[model samples]
Target chain A: GQQVMQIPQYQHVQEGEDFTTYCNSSTTLSNIQWYKQRPGGHPVFLIQLVKSGEVKKQKRLTFQFGEAKKNSSLHITATQTTDVGTYFCAISFGNEKLTFGTGTRLTIIP
Target chain B: DAGITQSPRHKVTETGTPVTLRCHQTENHRYMYWYRQDPGHGLRLIHYSYGVKDTDKGEVSDGYSVSRSKTEDFLLTLESATSSQTSVYFCAIRVTGTETQYFGPGTRLLVL
Candidate 1:
């Protein structure tokens, strides 16, 4: 079994400020995927990172996978109200079965 | 939003009752999964189906069972519902070769 934990259970930032959430796994992971769940909405796929120390960017968002493959991070630059949601990091167990992180709920105040 | 639909968007049941939640997909995906979301536990997988008649238990499979009789449908059943089972349940689908999962609107279940 694999376990993924996320930091800063809840984050509140100004609309123009930057924010970051981290995900750590108890065991080594082959790859990590990120998802975003808006309030009262379903989780939506954002991106996936493979290989050690991989980094990918989606517009204003940046995602990184640690060299050890046991940790990952999602950083948002200049957050906006549309960015308020729960961000989750999911890891697969040698296959397509994904284990999701605890999630970091982000709130942006204008 | 990926042609996924979960029935009875919300449900309220008493303890020791049998409840079944249905997940229907129009995408005809090979992989379908059932997940429960709580306040602090994030999303935990309960069961998943790889094919019409093939299903596997997930990490949180206890007290939950799933059946997939057709390619477009997956059902999650609770033999006897308990209060601890109250949570938001989501259904996700993934294509044969993709790692990304698209989710249904979700079903919120409350067991009293």
Candidate 2:
């Protein structure tokens, strides 16, 4: 089984500030997926990075996959109040089931 | 959002009772999954099904069992529920030809 660790179990930032969360793995991954779960809601898929050193952006959010394919990051610029939620990175070693990171909880102060 | 629905959005039951949660999806995806979300633990996979009557256990499979009778239906059963099993349950479906998973609204269960 693969283990993925996410940094900063919890984070709080003033609205309009920047926020970033990192997900690290001990071994190379086939692919990595990011998800966001609002308070009292189910997780929603945000994005997926499959190639080494891949970077993708959606609006103000940027996602990066390390060249080694063992790490990934999500950065939000000028975050809005809607950005408040828990961010999780998921990986599947060689199976259909996914192993999720502990996740980083983000709070926005409006 | 995917056409995934979970039955009994919320439930309250006593210990030692058998509880079953149903996951229905109209997407007709071949792969379906069951996960439990807690405070510190993000989402732990309990079970998943690749096709009808084809299922496998996950990291946290103990005390839980699953069955996929049809392509669109997956069921998770707790033979004897415990207080520790009281958590938010989510059902997800993986799109064909891709690894993307769409989750249902989720089921909140409380065991006393």
Candidate 3:
């Protein structure tokens, strides 16, 4: 069995501010993926980090995979109202099965 | 939005009843999963199918079972539902050998 934990269970940020959430695993992962679920919406695929110590960016959002492949982070710069949602980090231990973290719910203030 | 659809967008059933939720995908993906979302729990996987007639349990599989008779359809059945089983259920699909999973609009179920 695999377990994934996320930090800052909930984050509230004012518009134009920055936010970051961390994900950690008790076991090593083969790959990790990120997803965003909007308010009252389904979870949507964001990105996946496969290689250790990998860093990828999507516009103002930056994702990082730890060197040990046991942790990851998602950082959003200058957040906007559209950024309000729950961000989840999912990891696969050795195959297709994925275990999702508790997720970090974000709320943006006007 | 990835050609994935969930039926009975909302359901209100009584306890001790058997409820089945259907997930249909036009993409014909090899991997299909059922998950339930609750407060502070995020999304907990119920079951997943790798192919036709192939399914396995997930972290929160109790009281839930799934069947995949075709590559495009996955069904999640709750036998003898309870109040604790009331939550928003989502169906997701991913291509073989890929890590990305696309989810369908959730089906909100309430057991009275």
Candidate 4:
């Protein structure tokens, strides 16, 4: 009964440009996880944000959780060609199952 | 890199056929999950197993079933596959005491 909606279903940017994807949930979340799926590859766990208003960064990628814990965002600075893939935001409501967002497919122009 | 492997990386079958996908893990995790990925629908959970012989349905479990007979093996079966079942299926395992889930390589099934 939970829904996660992601914005900019598909995005294409120049090789050196930046990109951002937003994830909004209908209800507050206990925790949110970000995953990256490369072309022809499986989804890999990137990071998890449990505390409200938390921010985490990995290399050029930055992840932020909204203060209300109902939304999150992933921003990539100076994207590279290798950054082409779909980024998904997943949330769990104290259960074993995770509800994933529709996902944002990112493409980088070389 | 969780030592998770899926059998038959790619499969093509006809409608109404019975198909089964296997997920093998070396981590011996307690929780296993099966999810289907479509074009617009990111990853919809089909089923998940908490332990051996303990399973539950998920958001999209109508036509899919799963079994975890052993701690390292999980199987997803499609009794009567349909064209709508043509999609990539991913199997994941949740690390003990953590919410992080590691996914397998995935199985691409095409129902014609």
Candidate 5:
């Protein structure tokens, strides 16, 4: 069985501050996907990383995958109120299903 | 928005009762999945179906079962509900072997 673990179970940051979350897996993954879920909302697909040591950006959010394909990170610059949510990392290992990490819950102060 | 819809937005059932949650999709996607989200446990997959009548268990499939008799519908069943099963459930669909998955609004279930 594959297991994905995420660091910083909870984080609180002031508005305009930066934040980052890390994810590590027990096994190599073919691809990794990131998701965001607002409080009391369903998980929404954010982005996916496939290549080793790949980096992608979405506006103020930057995502990076480790060279071994077993770790990933999501960093947000100048966080806003809208950025308050739980971020999850899901890994796929040549299967139809995905194993999701515990997730990092972020809160932005006013 | 991938035309994914889940029925019974909220449900409250007593323990030992049988409950079935329905997931309907208009996108005609071949891959459908059921996941449960709790406070500490982010989102854990219960089961997934790749095609009609073809299904596989996920990490947390002990107390749950799934059926996919048609391409548009996937059903998750709890034979005898327990208090531990209280959580928010999500239904997601995607193109076969694709990374993009569209999730439903989600169903909150409480078992007493």
Candidate 6:
């Protein structure tokens, strides 16, 4: 069995502040994917990191994978009003299914 | 965006009732999954089907059943629904073996 957890279950920040959420897994993963879910929307795939110590950026959002492939992080710089949503990190170990973390709910203050 | 849709976007039923949720996908992917989302639990996989008539259980499969007789359709059934079964359910299709999944709009069920 595999387990994944995310830190800071809920976070509220000003529009211009920065935000970061950490994800840790009980077992090593073959790859990790990040998803975003708006208030009333479904989860949407954002990015994926397969290699250890890998980092990728999408505009203001940055994703990183640990060297052990058991942890990852997502950082958003200068959050905007539209950034209010829940971010989840999902991990998989060479399986067709993915184990999703508890998720971090972010609220952007306007 | 992947042409995935869930029937009865919102549903409300009483205890001891039978309910079914349908997931339709136009992607024609070989893999389809059903997951439940609650306040603290992110997304727990209930079941998944790799192909027509091929299915497997997941971490939280109890009290839930799934059927995939066709590649484009997957159905989740609850024989005897309870309040605990009230949660938002999502159906996803695997885009690749790498585990990239695209989710449907979601179905919110309320059991009273």
The alpha-carbon lDDT assigned to residue B109 of candidate 3 equals: 100
Q: What is the DockQ score of candidate 1, to 2 decimals?
A: 0.87
Looking at model 5, residue B49 earns an lDDT score of 92
TM-score, cand. 2 vs. native: 0.98
- Candidate 2 vs candidate 5: the DockQ winner is 2
| Cα lDDT tens digits for candidate 2, A1-110 | 77999998999999999999999999999999999999988899999999999999999999999999999999999989999999999998657878999999999999
**Deviating ranges (above 4 Å) for candidate 6:** none
Structure candidate 5, residue pairs in collision:
none
Better of 2 and 3 by TM-score: 2
B8-67 in candidate 1: lDDT tens per residue? Answer: 899999999999999999988999999999999999999999999899989899999999
Residues A1-110 of candidate 1: C-alpha lDDT, one tens digit per residue: 67888999999998999999999987888899999999999999999999899999999999999999999999999999999999999988768699888999999999
Clashing pairs in 6: none
**Could you report the Cα RMSD, in angstroms, for every candidate shown?**
1.2, 0.8, 1.0, 0.8, 1.1, 0.9
lDDT of 6 by residue, B3-66 (tens): 8999989999999999999999997899999999999999999999999999999999999999
Q: Which regions of candidate 3 are displaced past 4 Å?
A: none
DockQ of each: 0.87, 0.85, 0.86, 0.93, 0.83, 0.96
What TM-score would every model get versus the actual structure?
Answer: 0.96, 0.98, 0.97, 0.98, 0.96, 0.98
Order of the predicted models by DockQ, top scorer first: 6, 4, 1, 3, 2, 5
Q: Give the top-scoring candidate (DockQ).
A: 6
Q: Encode model 4's per-residue lDDT on B6-90: one tens digit a residue.
A: 9989999999999999999998899999999999999999999999999999989998888889999999999999999999999
DockQ of 3: 0.86
Model-by-model lDDT, in order?
0.94, 0.95, 0.92, 0.95, 0.92, 0.94
What lDDT tens digits, residue by residue, belong to model 2 across residues B11-54?
99999999999999997899999999999999999999999999
Which 10-residue span in candidate 3 chain B carries the lowest summed lDDT?
B93-102
Query: What lDDT score goes with residue A18 in model 3?
Result: 100
Relative to the true structure, candidate 3 reaches a TM of 0.97
Residue B86 of model 3: what lDDT?
97
Compared with the true structure, model 4 gives a TM-score of 0.98
